[model samples]
Target chain A: MGQVVLKGINKFYDSVHAVKDVNLQIRDKEFVVFVGPSGCGKTTTLRMIAGLEAISSGDISIDGSVVNGLAPMDRDIAMVFQNYALYPHMSVYDNMAFGLKMRKFTRPEIDRRVRDAADILGIGELLKRKPRQLSGGQRQRVALGRAIVRHPRVFLFDEPLSNLDAKLRVQMRVELKKLHLRLGTTAIYVTHDQVEAMTLGDRVVVMKDGVVQQVGEPLELYNRPANKFVAGFIGSPTMNFATVTVTEANGSLIAENAGLRIRLPDGTARRLRGHIGHKVTLGVRPEDLTVAGAADPDHPCFDAVIEVVEQLGSEILLDMKVGQDVMVASVEPTVRVNVRDKLRLAMRPSSLHVFDVKTEEAI
Target chain B: MIEGAIWRKWAFFYLPMALFLLFLLFPFYWMVITSVRPDGELYRPWNSVNYNPFWTWNPTWDHVRYLFEETLFAAWLWNTMFIALVSTAISLVCGVFAGYALSRLNFPFAGSLGTGIFITYLVPQTLLFIPLAEIIRNYRLGDTPWSLILTYPTFLIPFCTWLMMGYFKAVPKELEECARIDGASRWQAMLYIVIPVAIPGILSAGIFAFTLSWNEFIYALVFLSSPEQKTVPVGVTSELIRGDVFFWGPLMAGALLGSIPVAIAYSFFVEHYVAGLTGSVKG
Candidate 1:
């Protein structure tokens, strides 16, 4: 129901800058995800926005009003924590009613809102149960239900599904997406899971080491990552990186790495015109490589020894060693591969991502 | 064969535990027998011939009557209960706040302060009684039950505070943050959430405080000049001995009666006592 904007945010714990001068604008009703590894400041940033943590130096605005100096309750934001911090002593009904009671809602209003949230979460039967009596997934719903009953301007989720089992996590993920759709409230979700980021976020902000690497639509970030970190982090099985030397072969460009050399596509090669003979990092997602039957001159080809093979029912993952360099590739489920077998892989030139070796920035 | 092996395994496990239980309960069984023995056989040395004399003869209510009517045993009981209840309440209030602060807050010299609280327990009561008596006299609180209630927390609070600090630490920090976002102030969050969750810990601390005050003798003996103001432990021991002539019958009767409140309290909070006592030691 409200947009959130963070401007020039910087947080420092003593000399260590936990969140650098970051800027983000989240529109009303948008589902934005902050994704990164631990210590990357994603949770810190979310906490700052939630007002659970103070900003060392920055401004956060909710619905165009500055909230940097406000208390969490005064900021009118409800947060669901990773551990689902439901009041252990309170029944689900009271847990959800706590914020309403604090707000001095009428008895009828509190009852109605709590019941409505319980229905939405499909936990109507669990209203009388204490939090310790509920399973992890149900407790997570109660945490969400607690936030929902508040009817705050914005909702903040800090890795809310990280504690559940794999299957429950997936089920809850879908439930959260549906909840967002039904409510249409501006929400900020933080997680390290890229799949959750892709499936849940309207805009995914990839971060690394307290700095914003890139922010864009999920597919846009997936297809055209702004940097090597974003490129490697956004994809499943991860994008492979190879240290290669870019050289002018005849009139076109080719990247030579270890025991493999492949001509770059015309469009991609033209972008590398000035960088010829320089060291670069070749980035390619596992899905972009195919197990080729023969050498295709039109496409880039490399021979690699299969070190490990994993069959995941619908797809096959190959861990291959080409000379001294190792890379992972995802092939079709029908592709037969064995350990120590030499496999010819054809790279899709159009899908090849290149980055400067020194800066690790996308070229 | 496997079922027989499993039975053997369980028997081996229970053998030591069963012996331990019997060893623990034997002393209480002797105390009960001693309290019921007839007057003539009460002082008899433990022998095979005198073992059944108690069964044939009539049990006298003389010791019990002497304790209740001839002495201020009822008054001692009342005084002990009062001091224990008041001190336990005081310790809980002080300990809970101090514990929460130590557990959650960052203050100047917090580590040193925690160490200081723990060190108070290490100071021997015998060593500090003279100085504490002087201070109590200075405050004009000597010879009053208030002096014991006030002094008992000196020992109780430090240990109870340490106990509660550990209990509060076990609660996740995020629980309070959630409550805060729900519009609870820090104190409100503690009152509504933290304290309720720590009921077992508080009960354990309360039992410790009550028992310590109930059984305390050194400070009570030194500070209380009036028989009416004396706690049960000091009063019972002082009245039982008169120039090497010990009144064993009335003494044991009073001792047994005095221990009942503490024993019953221990049984009520036994679970929490075990949990809280070890928990405080670690803290």
Candidate 2:
């Protein structure tokens, strides 16, 4: 019953077009996350769905009913803001009961729901404490409790975990996933944190500059990003990009730059045949590049001078210079590496991504 | 607070703080002493036998009795309280709504309208009262409590509205939005979420409005002539002084008694008042 669909949604604030022609279909009990950098219109789209921001054009339908001009109260959705937005004057019990009271529920029913939500959030002991008296994580739980007491059709979260400390954010993230699983409510979450987006969403929507770059499941996006921006934004330590001219040699494509030359993978070369003799952007994730062993001649290997080695315990990240371009390679922690050392790095053939320079789209 | 040597702390903080406290409290001390001093001692020459100007050995309550029993001081106190309360209530209702609208709502000419209201406040009462006097006379409310009650909001509304607008702006708009999405209409959201969160601001504004109207002098002097209809500032000054003869003891007594309510109000809500001025809304 919680199917939400947005059709050609657009938003404009005076002369600036904030969101442009976004179309999305969210299934019942689906967790969809919209993720992008700041000013990418992700939060704006979430607000539009919550009915807090009016859409300039197109329609939004919740459970097959068009809700263009409907008030937020009529839309039957709840939003948890990044700052928690807890009513400071109210105790936790009252804060959770406010939504039920506003809807004219019986006092006993409201109390039952409030207590139920508090128990679910493990905050029953804090029922009488005001929001200011609680810690940030507790206040966040109260915000969630407030949203859950109403049993709204869809839940909108606008970076709800951004305010918590790192450990608390990870903990709350797991709790949020568990909560969504238990409630099975269709939820639309917005955040600029890619890790949160990947871990929590059933389908992640990547956006940039008010445009939807790609929408797919987490692994699909990681394996095959639709564009250069998605490829660069979805992974941590960011994907390394280098501009290289493509040339045909013996019916195979070779990507060459001023400092290094590498053969394109067979699958990538087939699609990039038309891009021969044209300069294209080559993208490779940090994890895909490792120290080249003597037996790794079949893979595309390049010489790079290590500039900095960051030991992150699990792996060592080597910041290296390949000609004029700088790239990062995540090597095994056991491998000995030092700054100013010359290392040969080989990238997995199937992991190479080539994008058209003009369109910034994968070729 | 100054952190370093004792001499630096004394020079930079303690000395200045002591001077400020003395300067601020000196007037209240003078008022209290003059109100309780006997007439014989108050008017004594500086060269009199064992003359002491600062300390009065013979303190009396006769001036307080004279003020309460002989003059219309009680009536004036009642009149001022009624007018200040009524006017503050009216202006608070109007100010809260107006401030919320101006700060939160998107409307045509909202910016210019706010500026216009502020400009109205900027017009000093010394000059604006001339036209206000005409309006009062035309409405036939002259020399009545209604006259002051109605006219006080002329300035009080703008003051309250301005203070309230800044307060409402400091409140995060997401609270109301979340309330709206949680099954409350806009008005409900404002009433349940916004207004409650803004209690500190409202209290500070209420205290300021009450003080302004209570101590108001020019409008009370020009509009209220009868001793029974006057407020404290006007009634005390007008009734206690005779032609070429000032009744200093009873005058000081009336002033001292008249200021007690405002003092009590400030002390009662001083914490909230300071918080409102600082304007911090923590989540």
Candidate 3:
């Protein structure tokens, strides 16, 4: 019963339009993530859904009821902040029970819910300890426990795992996914880390400059990005892009520049036919580029010189120079490569991406 | 602690520390010694035989006895305590709310309002007392404990407000936001989350306000002219000394006794006061 719908959501701070028109429909029990760089309006959109920020001109409804004028307390939602936001003076049990008490729950009911949440969070033994006495991970668990005790209709998270160390962040991300599955509550999470969005979200929304760029399942975004920003933002090593002029040769389109040349695959060539003799941006992921082999003769290949090699244990990342442009390639760890080595790299023909240079949109 | 050598540690840390301590404690040492010294030794010429101004051979409680039994010193002590406590309580309540609003609430001119309050504190009390005296006479609160008690907050509220505003700003706004999202109203969030977290700041503000009102002099002297209504600072200075003849023993004893309460207050909350100034919230 937690279906949330937003229509034409916008937020303005004086003259600055912080969040532009955004419309989304979140299914019940679904986990959605909003991700972008700083000031990209992801957090602002979440806050608007939570009723913490006033929408400039829009309608937000939870469970099929408009909540535009409702206060946060009446929104029937819970939030986990980045800093945990535990009450410093209260014990863990009291912290978990505060919401229940405010809602006028009976004494025994409050106790039962508090203890149940503590057990679920594996913090039953820490009920009497204050927040300052707990470690960071333990405090984070208490924050989650506090949110779960109320059994709110929705859960909002604003960069909740950003404060943890790298290892802890990964562990917490798994726990968060498990928690969402068990609770079956609608959750909206906002973060700047694409990896977190990819791992935890059923669907991820990509935004830039206060505008929604793309919205779909995580794999859809990785497989088919709508624009140049999405392709570069979703992957770890990032997609390499080069501006090349589209020229027709032998009834096939060729994208060539001072640094490299590539034959556009059949599907991309058909869409890019009208742009011949005009400059178009070519994009390819690092994993899609590899050392050329005999089987890759039909694929587009180019010459490059290795500039730097980074050993990542599982794989090696080679920063190579192709004429004036620099590109990176992820190859097998056993491959022996060094700086200034001349190499031939091949791109998977089916994986090549081309974009209109002016619009920066996929072609 | 200097890292390398023992002499570097001593030269850089211990030597300077000892000298600083001696320089700071010299006045208190003089007060304590003079309060207990015999009147014969206190007024004697420094050039006389067996005249050691630094140390006294025989100590007496006569000066202390004179302070308590002969004059209106006990009434002055009671007046000062009552006035300081009442004024501090009034100032703290107003200061905490004012500070929270000025720091947390987004309103028109909030920044300038905070600065304006601080500017009032910077106005010297020396210049303020004259206009205040005229107001006090018109209100007919002159020559009573109410005069000092009411006037002290004129300075105390601004100081307490400015200190508390800085302290409230240091507390994370996320705590209150989380509380609100967790089903608490704005007032409830402030009471349960913000006020408890701001206890150290409140205590530091209370301690400073109490100390300021306790030692306040110009207002006490101008508003309270009667001998019985005067506070410790006014009574000890005007009553203990006659023209060209300073009562050294009784005067020093009164000074020594007057400072004990403030000293005790500082030591009692020294840890919290330092933490308040440093603005440490774990989150």
lDDT of each residue in B165-191, candidate 1, tens digit only: 888888888888898899887778888
TM for every model, in the order presented, reads 0.94, 0.98, 0.97
- Residue B103 in candidate 2 has what lDDT? 96
Q: Once superposed on the true structure, which residue ranges of model 1 sit more than 4 Å away at CA? A: A293-297, B1-19, B44-57, B271-283
In angstroms, give how far residue A31 of model 2 lies from its true place.
0.7
lDDT of 3 at A164: 93
- Cα lDDT over the full model 2: 0.93
Among these predicted structures, which one has the highest TM-score?
Answer: 2
Question: What DockQ does predicted model 1 obtain?
Answer: 0.46
Higher-TM-score candidate among 1 and 3? Answer: 3
Candidate 2 residue pairs that clash: none
Off by over 4 Å in 3: A294-296
Report lDDT (Cα) of residue B127, candidate 1.
Answer: 92
Order of all candidates by DockQ, from best down to worst? 2, 3, 1
Q: After superposition on all CA atoms, how large is the RMSD of candidate 2?
A: 1.3
Q: Candidate 2 docking: what grade?
A: high
